[model samples]
Target: MQMLPLNMAAVTTVAMWKAIALIGLAVAEAFVVVSSSPRERSVSTQLASEYGASARTRTRDDYIDINRESGGPIVRYDGPTIRPLSNVRAPSLDEIWESTMPVIVQGGSLRTWSFANPQVDAVQVLFKSEGRPIDADIDLWNGPDNTPHKMRVYVEDGARRTFSAIIGTPRGPNSIAVRNIGQLEFPLDAVVRPDMQDGLAASIASVVSKAEVIQGGSVRTWSFNPVVQSVAVIIKTDGRPLNSRIELLMGPNNSKQVVEIYTEDGVERPFFAIVETPEAVGSVIRIKNTAPLEFPVYASVAPYTLGEYNFVGDSNSFNEWHML
Candidate 1:
């Protein structure tokens, strides 16, 4: 009788241990399944039929849609005769602006130039690729809406020069085109406002009374930019410790901007000046000179529009640029 009881207890103990072991294993497997959950992936197709035409579903079908678009740059076109897109990933701002030139496309993929509404389809890239750029052009067009528009583009001289321009609203979307019969002499270096200034240095004069204060962001690494080649930055001390700098920014594309900081001592080295952008309309360069370190700084811009037009030029703790 005693032996039978002992044997029964032993069998029960073994079964209990087996059950606990199985339960532990189940818990472990559950943990592994949860930990190894796959990440949610987003779609990136140039012309996916699902962009807006279909009810695209996300694995994380959270109703609150988010615009977490991450992928290579995109450039597309649509018109009476659309051609296959070329390999234009994040093309230079100058390249895109060239399409705005007065181009009369007669046949093939070549059509009259038109400034595509960047806010809708693309972001006007203002700078070219890395290195000194050698390619350039200008495209012109007549608006299909009985208006005319013009665009000037600085080739992605990679890094040869910095080109920048600021247009008043009157020169921008105000009208399709400015029908001024007369043309101005560009070779004289007398740049016009609101158009592509290619590569030149001009002053806004004393706009302090007309200027507004802009709060700045963080500093970033020092990188070269094609734009802002020759620039004169005039800052009002306004009783602050913020020292301004001249940066050789390329574009707002990939890679951080490059810079050649000029101080009151003047530019220590010769800044290679590329004239007549896209072509040498009359390219020229001036040897390095003293950069004004006065309360109001002055810089000369040329080459192409430096990548970072954010005016985010700030000083680090020690006065070095802090790339934001």
Candidate 2:
């Protein structure tokens, strides 16, 4: 055999090693691709378990450790990125209502609370609005003792608020009067008493009457003698177009309190009529469907005397405040 130069022989040896290394790398890449498949990974996992490796393989192309702890397979992350937890706290009902204090209008001449106690002349006014804040004159004169007491207070609106105000004693019956001082009308609620918040002592509402569907051009009537003062009348269109009239008759004279509801968009909206009766006498709820269509109606009258509070509702002008 003819001998080659020593440098050339060394170069040839280096080239042979490089070619082997490249071939090995290509084989390794091909094995990776094949093992990454679901079927191949499953088979590999089964074989690993049979051989005492107990390897766990996932469907996704995850970077997993094998024989990591000598007992079980390690799980690696190959899915979507996980999000960190948030630390911000949401506002409570009381905090949210406090923030609704009228920006431009500091206070109003509107008298919000009126009470006539033989011992106390002024009591705390706990007020809340179902919708946005309403600027209204509350005519609290509901009885013989309720002298002409009218006050304008910025009734903070939203959620079930129990904010208190120090105003003259609320007048009339437990039920008060609300008139929209602003051009627009909104649902308003108020509780009058001292040393408490709304619903802190109020009883959980009990269902006096179940839901009933009233046909078009018909009337559904319910009568009950309330032992307490507060009565909640709920009317819903059930997502159907509705134009109806709701009447709450109470007192000896049978004073008719009417609410005309018309849902133009056919949205399933429940209109609440919180009726503060003049007395715990005989009360009647009469719903008449003025529209020529069928609609569902429900009413629950809970007559509970909140120990330290007078749970009252607006008697007149629900037209201005019925968009609950």
Candidate 3:
């Protein structure tokens, strides 16, 4: 009787295992069915459509449709008649800025141009591709700070894309870069204009402030033979986001003053103090930059006086404080 019960128990266990195996197989088949659905496959096409109205949904069967379409950069209509202008414009290098150039970038490459003068307020990029659509990112940097403003663009092959502007500050040299993030290599005609005409006259006539600090950090001490009566310091950080502590010391030992300032991310910190001396005495000012990052500090001293624009030019630590 005990043996019979043991056999029955073995049979029950086998039946349970079979049921579990069937359930697992059903789940795997359901997952496959969902993943291969038409809805899942259309995701990429939907994303491409959102980039622009001209962007077409590309697919394996749609290869003929893409090829039938003509691609090239868009031409600007500058006259009464909408005729395509010649890429080869004025015969002089000085007039090259008013023309377009044919640029071919292979798959997975980037082109960078540091052709912008400080007067260039913006850059205009108009491009069209042949055969295959091109995907690229337009990068603009105000200076060599390595921080770039990026915009993603999609170009339909054989069709002209609308020109896009990369805006930047008119201060310092700007770098315009185009990165091909797509897998296809094709010829593209691009009209890139470094627009410097707008506000050019105004910029030339405008007086640049001498109060702007050059660079900060490193050397921090300044000693003057006859100490100034008062000192002020202004600290501003670049956009990289930083937290730093700045300590300033000024005046002689008898009436020495120490000011402690803390800077949080994105905020400018300031410090000011006056020195009291029984007589004309030598004074030293010290400043420190704990978060020593490039473009970390913009410093300026107080009281307009005829002194070196970089008054603290000799200071080893901070460039913002100058001996009057």
Candidate 4:
């Protein structure tokens, strides 16, 4: 065979092509390795990083033991851990204003109770039936403002029907009246408690980062940064009240706490829950509204240093309060 002189330009082009191919191959391999890593495989881990959750582990001392007793019914601590206002105390039914009224089928009867103290902020209504399901239409009135506050038309079956409403402002006196709308007659029990704004305000560590508007029949997730001890979500509709389902998920295992809020034709209401301890991976809050109307929502996460506290009086006391 006869040898021919080499073309340097052609040789250089081939060499460059070879180098580019090798570089591309290396980059593809790196991408595959990163995508298949254990950390990247976890959706929660990725979400935590995206939300700026701290990876550092928290010490036991960082948390306050609200329920120190070791071996009874394990009640997890949720809410703000901080000390409440000086005047704030656990809600009590003993010192509340309560009254009972007979249910009238035709023109619903009304029972009004006067509050000597003007600090009452919550009202609870319980319906007692005589061996049958009772249906009633209850209306709450703020006597000082002379305006109708909350109204509920519900059926009380075997279980005792208890309804609670939060009063936004302090009033001189209020009255709740129930009318029998169903066939069965029942007695209505109403109780009122003072507002918990002072205690709840003292527990809030920071305002919500942002508010998200979600359409009806849709679900949205809110991730917290620097995981909080507790979270309170305020859901507001334009003019009608709707039912909402909330889920709180924490840790790598994604432990869940669920809360459901059902309201009538009202302006706004709040739903609150808390985690026993802070999670390094942060927490995920999911809200689902099944109503036909869209609404606006915002969540306030309680500070880790102190959990929020509301009056947890008798089993029937309305404890949760709006953040003022």
Candidate 5:
């Protein structure tokens, strides 16, 4: 090999290029370390926590959990979730108003009553007996046309039977006829009312009212007045047990803050709850059933009043009614 003279300038330029490449690699590594640091991680974790909290507040049974093995957050949802009734359309007050009267029927003859208002769409007949089992048959006929629009037969033993029937088209005048076909005389109560649509809408709009018989697997919601201090909910089931849940929404944003579970064993029971501080302008209550079969369910709400009570030495206590 022949020896050649070395160029110092060229050697210095190569050293400079190597130094620049090493500096670039160091800068890239530093950038990755800063991105994965505790401060950055904490920011992302906080954002996730806030999102989870907001989502859980809107639903009845949704939450976040941490995985034990992996130490990672997991979201879980157990449903039949309750929702607000703010957007539900309700009936007018006049539609639900009932002009109820007492009716008595004897023998196997039919008795009819002509509507004083002339313009009506529906009729409700409620029959009750105290002695033996009785059967009642009811029919509704529209005036002028004398068209038999609706009819029903009810057979029950010392129990109340209510039949609500509708007339297809509006009429100038209408008549409702009821008869006791059983061996016993029946004492009954009758209500001449408007269509059910108006009544149902009115009930949902009012703060303290009764709801119609709700079928299984259906959900209903009611709104409360702002001045209400507390509310009492009464539920009645027809024949089978009812598995239901109630959710209460509070605050302006209507967050699901309170929850109640109800199991009705073919009986009437009342459930009550109190309002929290900084009372909500309005609150919403939702009822949902998890059963597969359809059953008759009625719910009503009323304001709670506090009164004085005197406790005697015995197990019984005397309660006095007084305005709070």
Candidate 6:
């Protein structure tokens, strides 16, 4: 038999090393399964024992080591004010007579709303071309007080957004309508006191992302509330194609940092994909329309479906998901 070349011998040695490593890993895994309580030995346990050497765990306080093998985001809820929208059973926001902010235009003025004890989340202000004036559910995050919230009017379709600068300065009913949004419940401090003339302690903060809006849905929504201090949705469609803009509200609506996306058509299709879950802080928004119509509200809230999710976080009041 011809002897192997020098280079070939080196290659053989490397391959042997790799093979040995793989075998070692397999053996470790088996040992873990064999060592664990027979009843407790599961696929997860076996894999963990074999490759993922137990980090450390002691009976005392410092003895317990957090094994982070999942390599996913560390889901945490430590915010002071946080909760779900349904906790307080908010009166489904159908109509709101908000006090619009004062604005000096070409000839008239508009008073933007300052709701009493303004508890709003998934809140919006939508306008109807045919029905009574629409309401825009503008989510207001926490921020410095006395800031102005503004929206330029126009038409939109699909992944496109257009704004028609009102010929010159904007005006009345013909002008775009503005109102405070309300969903399952009023968010923390989103309400104004009966005594205070303007928005109470509720200053705008960072708004959550503009949830997925594929099929023709447009409206402002937040991931959490301040009062109920939880999470919820507030969606309003104008029949035409729409794109959801995730607005991060900065102090008194001083302005908005916006992020947007379209939704999957609920009528004919359902976008199905098991998106690898990021850290726990990330929100997994699955907007599925169970009904055929789209107007006032959306289908039932999730979690209740699999009888898993829909619970307050262990630490805070924000919404928490459960896998069934």
lDDT of every predicted structure (CA atoms): 0.29, 0.43, 0.42, 0.45, 0.45, 0.28
lDDT digits (tens) for residues 1-324 of candidate 2: 999999999999999999999999999999999988876335446566665542344432233223344442222222212111112232222443465442221223233334444343333334555546655454435465643333343433323222333323323133344454544345444444432223222111232335666778888776643232335455555566556666656544353444555543233233433443323234576778777755544433343221111113222212222111
Local accuracy of candidate 3 as per-residue lDDT tens digits, 1-324: 435688899999999999999999999999999988875334457656685444555444322111122341111112211111113221221133245564666657787777546665555455555646656666665555654344455544423222222234345476767777777555454555664542211221122123343343543554543223323334445554333333223334321333333323323212212222111233454545555556455444332111222111133212333344
The digit string of per-residue lDDT tens for model 1 on 118-153 reads 322111113233343322221222233422212233
**Model 4 clashing residue pairs (backbone):** 79-307, 79-308, 80-307, 80-308, 81-306, 81-307, 82-306, 82-307
TM-scores across all candidates?
0.19, 0.32, 0.31, 0.36, 0.30, 0.20
- Writing each residue's lDDT as its tens digit, candidate 4 over 1-324 gives 966557977898899999999999999999999988876344457777655543356654454323345432113334334432224353322123233343323324554544445565443443433334544554455554554443333433322223333433334455655555454245444433334554332222233344566666778876653224434454555556656666656555353444455554335334322222233234676777766655543334432232333322232212332222
Give the residue spans of candidate 5 off by over 4 A: 1-99, 116-118, 143-145, 158-169, 185-187, 193-197, 200-324
Q: Give the distance in Å from residue 246's predicted Cα in candidate 2 to where it truly belongs.
A: 1.8
**Alpha-carbon deviation at 103 in model 4, angstroms:** 27
User: Candidate 6's residue-wise lDDT over 95-163, tens digit each?
Assistant: 112443322111122324333232232122322222111123222222334111233222212011111
Off by over 4 Å in 6: 1-52, 56-206, 209-211, 216-229, 239-286, 290-324
User: Cα RMSD to native, each candidate?
Assistant: 20.6, 23.3, 28.4, 17.3, 19.5, 22.6
Clashes of each: 68, 12, 10, 8, 3, 58
**What does candidate 5 score on TM?**
0.30
Pick the winner on lDDT between candidates 1 and 5. Answer: 5
By lDDT rank, best first, the candidates go: 5, 4, 2, 3, 1, 6
Clashing pairs in 3: 70-158, 71-158, 71-159, 72-128, 73-128, 219-316, 219-317, 220-316, 220-317, 299-320
**Cα lDDT tens digits for candidate 5, 1-324:** 965547877888899999999999999999999987876334358788998779768652243223345443221123112122223353222132233445667657678866656444434344445544545555555556454433334433333213222332244466767766765455544444444454432332344455566677878776654333334454546646655555555545354333333333434222222222113234566666655656656666454322122222221322221111
Badly placed stretches (over 4 Å) of model 4 are 1-119, 122-193, 201-206, 225-227, 251-255, 265-281, 294-324
